[model samples]
Target: MKFITLSNGVKMPILGYGTFTMSNDETERCVTEAIQVGYRLIDTAQAYRNEEGVGNAIVKCGVSREELFITTKIWVENAGYEKAKRSLEESLKKLQTEYIDLVLIHQAFNDYYGTWKALEEAYKSGKVRAIGVSNFYPDRFMDLVTFSEINPMINQLETHVFQQHKNDKKFLEKYGTKLEAWAPFARGSHGIFENEVLMQIAKQHNKTIGQVALRFLIQNGIIAIPKSVHKNRMEENLNIFDFSLSNENIKKIEELDLGENVFMDHENAEDIERFFKMFKIGNK
Candidate 1:
């Protein structure tokens, strides 16, 4: 596995295990297999409600707590200085760890500034190794990073073959923030698994399209966390380190970018309304 040093000097694994929309049982099983297959970076979020499972896996993975990088997010409900700090303590208990490797604001909603302040405090106290934001677009991202006492170490987004944050990447690099991809396969919702171009590239390298997709992001210095319940597929997601994509291969994949988010547009008023409805916080 490769590593990227965040602006804050934290070494984060370039590829990790993501636990999103997973049941507690599923998280326990899959995270266990993922660790056994050589994954040291484990990502879970308070919204995912599976941190307990992740914590359980950590205790049973036979890997020392110091060797693993555990990450979780502060959800919208817990989006302020006091609440964020309190929530992280709850997360640490659920995750069964004294300190988390990384902690991120799950979204741009609620009192994210307050949430960031809490994260900063956590950082100062040595409870979190690094701090960041997820799903922050270019404008919102710049605003937060500008006034932040400590610039965000990373920004997690929905980056994949179709919706490759081309402009976002440019600015993140300019501001010295690392970009992490949440759904590296577009949740397999974008025909990405069998896209003609990606399939061709995969055949040439004898790699699965999933591996090719993840490799492209990792080679570009983006941290990618591809999730799967199947042990074999989990193993496949971690096996992309052996092959390299040539410049031409990288160019071909780059052209596949849709230039827009393949998932919901966080900037759209209508989309935001519907998306937030999925969660029942903040008087919704």
Candidate 2:
């Protein structure tokens, strides 16, 4: 697997496995298959309620803890310094790890500065090797990075072929934060699977549309975590390193960008309201 060095000098895998909607049982099964397929980076979150499943898989995967790069996010309910710090410890216990390879605030809302402080403390104390934020658009990202003691090593975003986040990438580059893509396949939204351009590219490269999509993200220096429950799909996603995309191919994919998000938008008022309501209801 290839890696990108973060601003703080930690190397992160260019590709990973995401446990977004998986239950504890499903996470364990899929993560086990994923690890067997040679995935070293495994991303989970407090909201996912499957950290224990990931932990189970970790113990059974026959790989040393040091060989895996485990990541989990702080949920909205765990938003302040005391809460976030306490949550991190709980995550450590559920993940069955003495230390986390990386940790991030799950969203831009809910006292993220306080959450970041907790992450910074974890980093300083060696409980976490790297720290970052997820779903933070440029404005909030800038605010946090500008005032925070430690700049985020990464900013995970809803990036895909349709929602390319090109400008965001350039903006984050200025601050030395790497852009990581969740839903790199657009979760099959925006007709991403059936898109003619991706299909044609896949045919040319003798790869699947999913492979081409993931390749596009990684080629542009974005870290991709493509989730799948099937072992075959897991293996296919991990097999993109053998071939490279040509410049012409890259341009065609670039033109497919719509410059809009296919999923939730952080800047939208309704979306922001939904987030507030959802987290207020409760968090796992």
Candidate 3:
């Protein structure tokens, strides 16, 4: 239940429930269970295609709208000012909310500057509380921060124990931007679940490897949105507040950083081109 104040002075939960791959039915059920488990932040994106399901759960859960921190992203296809603005309204309709706690550019590709302008306008109009970008590396992130009229308040990226984004964290700090982690568990890749170091740490703390991984990120001031469909796993992900990892344990986990992305790199030319193509077709 810890929170981080964004550059714009908005308090965001340090931990949240992400609806990335959760199906429509599963998203409704999982998000409802997550709220009952004490999660107030819910992160969804236009590309995820489950905004309605999330909205349904929010309404059915009977939680007041003001108590929940809801976030959604503008997809790449809606990159122009007009399109982005229209998409925001559409998202509002789908989410069944009058105002969004946060809205982010889902990816760095396409006319993000145009999309940013829409976000700025929306923020000023009180339709969005905060605005940001996702999957933007240090270079692009800095570029946007430098030229934009309103600085980005958050930068969501691929962050986990194996790829801590230490250098990016420093750059974001310089720009007064907060770091939010998408794949906080590394999507179970690179043997993250079975790593000896994490296993030993988990054994000592009597916690799961996933708990150790999430605790490591949150202790370092990064917001983590670990998604799970199962109610038990969702509750487990929210149970990292009791214990603290010692400095020695933190340093040991720091040594595990590989300094590279375990997921797709947005900087690669082909990858970027393909991403834009998908947006052009509005498939995602």
Please tell me which predicted candidate would have the highest lDDT against the true structure. 2
List the global CA lDDT of all models: 0.91, 0.92, 0.91
Candidate 2: which stretches are off by over 4 Å?
279-284
Q: Assess candidate 3 and give its lDDT.
A: 0.91
Candidate 3 similarity to native, TM-score = 0.96
lDDT of 3 by residue, 116-143 (tens): 9999999999999999989998778878
Backbone clash numbers for all candidates listed = 0, 0, 0
User: Candidate 3: worst 10 consecutive residues by lDDT?
Assistant: 275-284
Q: Indicate whether candidate 1 or candidate 2 has the larger lDDT.
A: 2
- Residue pairs clashing, model 1: none
Predicted structure 2: lDDT: 0.92
Which of candidates 1 and 2 reaches a greater TM-score?
Answer: 1
lDDT digits (tens) for residues 1-284 of candidate 2: 99999998888899999999999999999999999989999999999999999999999999999889999999988999999999999999999999999999998877888999989999999999999999998789989998999999999999999989999999999988899999998898988889999899999989999999999999999999999999999999999998899999999999999888776777788977776776563442
TM-score of each: 0.98, 0.97, 0.96
Kindly indicate the candidate among 1 and 3 with the higher TM-score: 1
For all the candidates, what are their Cα RMSDs to the real structure? 0.9, 1.7, 1.8
